[model samples]
Target: MNDHDGPTPGNLVATVRAVLPSLTPAAQAIARLILEDPAMVARSTITEFSAVSGTSEATIVRTARALGFAGYSQLRFALAAAVAREEPERLVPGDLGPDDPLTDVIAKVTRAESEALADTAAQLNPDRLGTVVEAMVAARRVDVYGVGASGVVAVDMAQKLMRIGRPGHAFADAHLALTSAALMGQGDVAVGVSCTGETPDVIAPMQLAHKGGATTVAITNNPRSSLAELADHVLVSAGRETAFRPGALASRISQLLIVDCIFVGIAQRTFETSQAAVRATRSALDEYMADTRRRNK
Candidate 1:
């Protein structure tokens, strides 16, 4: 496939330039609209673009088809990717400025979540994530190890997997984690979550697990991080850098989303087993709560 074959909404400007001359007058008009305002193309649907460009939906589809995508979805994805690359500093909408009034916390949180969703879209690699999930699903056991703020996310993932009857542990202590890592073998899975991906404490154990022949998964903000390089499968977290604002917020949120994605994938793939596990776990918790209530009474 040539460069044009993988056109994303982000590269619509380039695609328009490359294909404009070849298109008929009607298609060229749509191309002009896209180049003039690629963000509009990124934010709007094909039908909306067609209406705003004064062209028919068929014309838009034909234009995208001519540009080498299977359909309009591919074209829009390309456009959004291109736009995201251009703006490295765009906070999620309402997060544009800091120091808002106390009453605006809700709006701020909403914007932050919106940005998280967009970052997830811009950075996620479905193929890579699927591979990691597959490894977790087939593993004999799973170990989740992390340190610092990422450690919290690791523990949260462990709890969720436990509910689904996956035998896993989240290790916060360096020594205990290393010992557990030494026990990992082929068919086991070891996960390391680190935003910077350079934490020595987290990497040391994951490296041992990798050497033990276990399938390793690393969820990190940096795709090029040492953690990603060490693990067999990498789940990337999309987050923005900020000053005075802790990486804790963005990194943890992204990590949570990554865990959620993996959990959902595993649940869908092992529907019956996961459902039974969930039910059993919930029942156990209810029974424990009932016993506590009776004692109090």
Candidate 2:
């Protein structure tokens, strides 16, 4: 139900990263191989992969299953599919290099962002999305919390909800966010957005909301982080950081894609009200534009 209309082989590296912490050391090595060069791993047989990882075939099978694949063969199939699905030009490593031409920089950035969007779409679970949308629609009010780059996305999410006649607020300040969570209760819902999943500003408010009996949701890149553990529903975005912009998420296209899905789902669930709200909002904007034009004339 995502951009692909359903699940396709997303980034095999992302799938592996989601479960990386739980893997055994030997299995972890093989997992790293999959992450590092999935194309090579895909072409490698069990015996060959075993030799590459310095692990036995038995360990390979266990690693494959741990990664949610049926077996080693299935793992390789997914990796191959993911690699094959990429554009031929994108086959090269996406890392930005120093002293590279400006054109190459542009291409690398576009490639990274494109991969982040597609991989995020692939990893997004439709059932979880439905749950979040349902919670948003039924909530008395929704509070969104984020800081820095994620805060921008939080504002966009809240704006979309408000345009659809839903009571939504975005808080960038920790004090304001915590205050909002303080009043939340059973019928309310709170969402925290943090790329690294460890942002104290976001996590504190969401944890408080959870303790106050409100439904809490987390949208983060790291599924194994504290924010994910705290929220009632966790939405993961597969945005791998690139050397171009190490810490900042830039436009955070992957997270925005997740928000778009949530907003669309909620709008679909309450079509008539949302449609009317959108129309009304648009008319107000049009009127403002007309007034500005008349004044200019």
Candidate 3:
């Protein structure tokens, strides 16, 4: 409800999930109906959909607007487009049962990861990604912030940037993140990584960095989330999780893919410098590898 931009229309399912937490109960019922059977929703009339969702026509319109659509008509068009683009081979993991076999578990998890990656790629706005990359390349320093599982992603991103001759630091601790962000000023970039985009530990530092005159970017699934509201750029990821997995594996895979995209974009812009820095870093690790080999022998 802040000044954040609405969701993109290219990937309706991802958009639905991203905004699910913020939807009103009546709107959420309609959202769930669409999510469960997008193809059916695409063909259903407004009257038919209202009956299926057990909500009023007005609530359905609100749900459509909440998802960044103009109204039910636009939402229907987007859903139709999405259903048309759906791949036959693509797998959607159902609720896992306790007695599921190991093979089934592997299949389902891998399928979820695959779908998350594909959906994220489809929904990602290239122009936004380019803007973030350009900002990072010109930044005097970069500060990455995340908490919980996202903390690992932040660290990975910092390492990638550092290896490309960029000076960057990652903070997983809330206090340290705030302290580091406080020191940032103009020409610096602060990146916040959070799946839900509502983590106070991540959002607080990002807000601080913004107030301190640094450019802020949010890598999250929800484009309208609190962190996104404060960001200069928002890079969204997509993932669907079962109750058992929660936001664990699928979100990580999607976030890592976006991280890799940003890293590669920056590297491409600073080609010779990035190549040299990567080689130097690799060379510096040779001695440790040699020592380990000798000890093993």
Candidate 4:
């Protein structure tokens, strides 16, 4: 369920990251090794993994259980399943190099975006999603916060909510975000979006929102991130990129995927009002355009 309760099959890496912050130093090292290359961990024996990871077998077993596995054997089985599901011959992190032609660039970019969405879907738990949706729909207002690429997502979420007859606001400026968050109370839902989940711009407002008794939510790639720690609900996304690939590109795509789902869920729950709102907005726009044309004529 990506609830950080435990990892599902072929989703070991994401779940491991979700719980990494709570693990001991020794356990964190093992978790990092698995994140770096699960295939290698899957193939390595417990003794070899311990030797390479610089941790004892005892710590390794503890790490496994801490990650929600019954033991080391279960952890290995999950890691192996995750590795076996990787795309064959795919680019490492699906990054485009300087020498790649335009054609390859097009194909590679599309493939990377597609996989990011798919990976996020695989990790997303419908129950978790339902909970977030319920919060948004019931709140008196929804406030979304982000900076840079994530700011775009925040704006989109706010705009969609407004269209569906919900009071929504988005903030990119740190001061204004905190100002709004400070006023939010139990009737508000505050969503902070950050790819790395460590952006100070985002964390500050989220902190304020939480302190003000708002229901806070975090949308991030790293589930164990600081931003995630402040929220009542966490929606984790997936990002696959190389050092050369900009962090904003792949991460933003996954963020948008979650935003889209949230919008749809809200709309589905308020079907009558949502449809009426859309129709009214469309009619108003058409009337404005027609009046402008007549004046020009």
Candidate 5:
């Protein structure tokens, strides 16, 4: 069995980015060197990498482990594969420098978001997503659980599914979420949204839903997290967090992309009904818009 739980084998940079925050200081030093230039690292020997990263050989091995690699040699091979597939223009976001100007910050942030989305798309397992979508489309009802920023994403997903004539609800409150999850059965679907995949508020409800026999899905950045372990299907997202932005923007963007994918897949599966429902919802909104226009006039 494969011991690594990070990104898929060919996506070394993304795997590193996803686990970077959890690595120790000595390991991070080695990781930074690899991230800065994966191709260079791939070509370098372990001793060279240790010297360049200002870390010991043991630190290098530990860093490799933190990235879900069994050892330095495996990491090196994966890095080589990543280098072969890497695009010249693709940019991986590094730590935000204190003296970066406004323009540079904007560029860096946009690049980070782009990379996160790309990595997520690359790492997504289509069979897993398809299975979840099939379960959701055939479900009697769907319940989504999230807290804080993830709660907002859950609401967005629920709204999308509802607009497409699917019976879906989002719960952010812990008590309410648990209550709702407890009522789910085999024909129901439950989705949990958490970037870190360790949010207790989100994970508990998902666990309840699973125990209740609902098909459980987890959208998270960490595949090794408890949420993923509990889920029937796991959708992974990729984003690197900096000191200034902990689990902010990039994570949200990545999660939203996954939400949109699930929504679109379901909508496509029930095309005619979804189209009719969308039209009906739009007509209802149009009437409200007309009333507001008349009032303004």
Candidate 6:
């Protein structure tokens, strides 16, 4: 393995650029490919990457080593970690440690959010997103399945989609979710939300939906996850992991952004229909709220 140290080759794009003035032309070309889009590099095999980046295989190894990876595999792993780190919410204005002054926490959180945006912007696949958006727009029905924190996001997605006139549902329970999946058929769409993409509940429903001729999409921090493989398309979220850090906050925020983006895209594509749906949803909600208020009084 090429051994070099910051994060991954992709995470170090800015660092590579800062040092580019000192690098050879071949190295510069390789650096450009990684910086331009790390996911592209992550998806590529060494031989394929070398040819596309116009650098020799040896140069690729050197580049990975320069990035502080033991080799290409290590480089990829580093990229995964970097992606994970960006998957959370931006730190709020004053969330720094007690030992840190208010200003320090503010600065740290600001930097964290900025980095998260940058990582997600860099990591997002427009083409893949477009494909999923299209599927969502054309689907006969939509179902979202997730467990735990991810289940919450799935419900949020369903709520938003419902507002836009889409017939969507979120199942927090695994057995009911699998049953829901059985009800899906051709031309429908199913989405699974799992930060780890390993939850059996989410996977079972997603798999069942797919087998029923529904198009399945997996949104997760782990692209290599079993859920991701079960999906017809995958949307990746940026996430970060630290020894003392919790994965919930940031990962949820990142996933929410992606979900919101998809919802908006669908709304735009069906603007008039969505508007009507929104109106209907508001009416339904108003009636339900009034009934509950009356019963309580």
Please list the Cα RMSD from the true structure of every candidate, rounded to 1 decimal place: 10.9, 4.0, 2.4, 3.1, 3.3, 10.5
User: What is the TM-score (0 to 1) of candidate 4?
Assistant: 0.86
Compare candidates 1 and 2 on TM-score and give the better one: 2
Compared with the true structure, all predictions reach lDDT values of 0.75, 0.81, 0.85, 0.83, 0.83, 0.73
Using TM-score as the measure, name the better of candidate 1 and candidate 3. Answer: 3
lDDT of 6 by residue, 192-213 (tens): 9987778899999988998999
Backbone clashes in model 5? 0
Q: List candidate 2 stretches off by more than 4 Å.
A: 1-8, 17-29, 43-51, 54-66, 69-74, 80-92, 247-251
Compose the digit string of candidate 1's lDDT tens values, residues 176-269: 9999999999999999998778889899999999899988888876555678788877766654434534654766887899899999999989
Give the backbone clash total of model 3. Answer: 0
Considering summed lDDT, which 10 consecutive residues are worst modelled in model 1?
A: 1-10
Off by over 4 Å in 1: 1-100, 103-106
lDDT of 1 at 66: 76
The TM-score-based order of candidates, best leading, equals 3, 4, 5, 2, 1, 6
lDDT, candidate 6, at 167: 82
Report how far off residue 53 is in candidate 4 (Å): 4.2
Q: Deviation in angstroms for 187 in model 3? A: 0.7
Best by lDDT: 3
Candidate 5 local distance difference test against the native: 0.83
TM-score of each: 0.68, 0.83, 0.92, 0.86, 0.85, 0.64
Instruction: Report the C-alpha displacement of residue 247, candidate 1, in angstroms.
Output: 4.2
Evaluated at residue 68, the lDDT of candidate 3 is 86
- Candidate 4 lDDT over 46-82, as tens digits, reads 9999999999999999999877889888888887777
lDDT of 3 by residue, 1-297 (tens): 124344444566677888887788898788877777878888999999988888999999989999988899888888777777673124234656798898988888887887789778877778788988999999999999998888989999999998889998999999999999999999999999999899999999999999999999998987878988899888888876567787668898899999999999999999999999999999889878999999999
Task: Write candidate 5's Cα lDDT for 1-297 as tens digits.
Answer: 013345444466667766665668888777777777878888989899888888888888888887877888888888777777763235355557889898888988888888888888887777777888899999999999999888989999999999989999999999999999989989999999998888999999999999999999888887768887898888888875678778678888889999999998998999999999999999999999999999999
Which tens-of-lDDT digit does each residue in 1-297 have in candidate 2? 112122236555565655565567888788777767878888999999888889999999988776666788888787788778762233334577788899998877877777778678778888889989999999999999999889999999999999999999999999999999999999999999988788999999998999999999988886767888888888878666655685445337888999999999999999999999999999999999999999999
Error of 1 at 149 (Å): 1.4
